[model samples]
Target: MTEKPAKLLPPNPTIGVFDSGFGGLTVLRDLLPLIPGARYIYLGDTARLPYGSKSRETIARYAVSSAKFLEEQGADLLCIACNTASALALEDIKQAMPIPVVGVIQPGAEAALATSEASPSTPKSVLVLATTATTQSHAYAQSLNALGLAATEKACPLLVPLVEEGWIDHHVTAEVLRIYLNEAFAEAPNAQTLLLGCTHYPLLQPLIERTLAELNHPMTIIDSAAATAADVAAYFPPNPNGAPATSRFYATDSIEKFQRLGSAFLNQPVSEVHLLDLGG
Candidate 1:
């Protein structure tokens, strides 16, 4: 008797990724290759960016609006890839959206914990480098501490601007990172893992590693963008022979700037970016 062929699921699921600005493209970049069959929609609320300065209530409102927009666009799942929004507004977005929502903070902390557990004999501590808002929220610290790992969070407010300026390997950027890492290490001298809590930081991974070596603190660096992508991937089944992934970009502000700067973050050409207005 001939055996029945294996059942096949839909070739693609519409995934929506939202951020307060262009940084989150790093997460989408990782997701693209991993989940090759998915249709991705990326929204950068650039008009109201620097969400770091906004209050929790304001951030929540903006995040919810973005989430709803994605839902309207038929997103089957959503990824809140902004650290500030993830820290302050994840719950609101989750409740507002009908689709499943994932945030960056939790997966990052979990990845740190798993990395620590991998070496059972040594004491493990995590150092999180993030935006001021995320550090102030203490989301990463709380999550890691809950998993029984000591955690320290450092707010690198300058890194975002530097990355956005396309200065990933500039000497000035390196010096800035050195200063930040110096202070961070001073606070968490024993930290064996360094978690890049900002989505933009992935573009500076090599520079970070070099800085850590210079500081005499060679630690395992965890890219939260990659970690969050890995977590999101768990929700979808394998799509080995599925169609090539496609993406749509939307920005609440200048589409030209989004296309130009976003290309750096996504590590690929961003050809068409639609302008959106999420309102004040």
Candidate 2:
């Protein structure tokens, strides 16, 4: 009998994407097209959300718990989709976990750099709209420095709750965003590049774009989820033929709430969500 050629075995685990809350679903939505055949498990700590307001120590603790849960779920790769956790506890999580870790911060930064490089005027300044914690973390600023661009970050504190409540098109939503945008622009008037640093912000993209258009400013808006999704795509197996991709959603609190609010983020009906208690 002739010896058989060695067969290539597929990876036996799923990719875990963790975020403070449903905001990370936006990242998942963007990543779906990039990795069509990969399996994914997403966990949203809705009970302990607004990680932006918590201390770094608390955020790290939450991150640890989240990572542990994913590990138990047979995750071979991890993606920290929350900028707050990525900024505060990425190193600790990476060190504690056995699998390779990826984050949204660097990918967003790289996109900002590429956007700047492509523009003729060289982008005198760029605006980063993120959570209060992300702005304080200075993750975007450091990334922009590595690429030689002056970046300014604005903390849009009210936007998260607005997004979580599914108020993307509410009249008050526009007013709230306008106030933050005005404040951020005041701080960095020359900023010609704008970065939607938080995943939830993308849901408000149309409003944001309209606001920018009304201002009559020629600025480029960067969607961080899209950029991070591209990064996630680069890590898949080289072969095109593989198992079809599948996604699972988990929440620390109400699965009903997650399914309802998640429709806005995922742009589809979220029929299944498992409740997980992340006791810290």
Candidate 3:
């Protein structure tokens, strides 16, 4: 929906969403209801995932390759749903593709600014909790500042692994969140908006709210996945008359794991995941 183009909607358009792993499905999950008429193609670069650890150049290469793949599939628009990719290589991917490529970080910062504006804060400030690579990129800080909202980014290195392990409701996860929030709050005491900067963090949202309540720090929690979905939805309206929206799942490797874990993220069973060989 974002980065408006001269022409939009090609009559039941194809939208491609790419993530390093299952996380992007969460973005797809939100999109399904909003844009029910468009066809969705989601590709998870699972075999080469943990894009966080890669260098900027390497990450750019991988992300561009993935984006080009989706473009080849006839994608009218692309969503870089992975925060790591969004942070480090969004421009690279954008340059390589002719389609509009929306990333999670900018939409998230804009959403946080909206939240801050609606709140009673004298000046807007945001506390972002994301993976190490995302925080390290300082992407959120730069974006929020550009919008006149102060930003504080905390790297929750353990959160991704714990979420991937399906320990979302576990006490350990809650305790870890507690620590991270407390640390972030200390850095940005006036921040009234908390941005979940990573896709994996959305699944832990309920627990995060609980942790915030327990800590007595009541800040508006912003889910970037949802924000990115809304941004994409801004481009088109529902096509109820045309065929129902259908989604195709693709992965570079681990079809079984993608189906099993992806369902949790998408909130629906992922059908036969086609194995794609986008090499190293």
- Model 2 misses residue 265 by how many Å? 0.5
Candidates sorted on TM-score, descending = 3, 1, 2
Q: Which one wins by TM-score: 1 or 3?
A: 3
Query: Backbone collision count in every prediction?
Result: 0, 0, 2
Task: Give the winner by lDDT: 1 or 2.
Answer: 1
lDDT of candidate 1 over 1-280, digit per residue (tens): 0112133224588999999889899999999988878999999999997898888999999999999999999898899999999899988998888777889998898888888888886567889999888999999988888889998999999998898888999999999999998898788888889999999999999999998888788899999999999888777778898788999999999888999998888889999999888789
Please give, for residues 1-280, the per-residue lDDT of candidate 3 as tens digits: 3366565566588999999999888899998877767899999999998898899999999999999999999999999999999999998998899988899999998888787777754448788898889989999999989888888999999998898888999999998888888888888887778899989889999999898889887878899999999998777755667777899989999999999899888888887899999989
Q: Which pairs of residues collide in model 3?
A: 1-232, 1-235
Model 1 is weakest, by summed lDDT over 10 consecutive residues, at 1-10
**CA lDDT, candidate 2, residue 139:** 89
Task: List candidate 3 stretches off by more than 4 Å.
Answer: 120-123
TM-score of each: 0.95, 0.91, 0.96
lDDT of 2 by residue, 184-234 (tens): 878898888888899899999998988888777657888888887777666
TM-score of 1: 0.95
Candidate 1 structure lDDT: 0.88
Cα-based lDDT for every prediction: 0.88, 0.83, 0.89
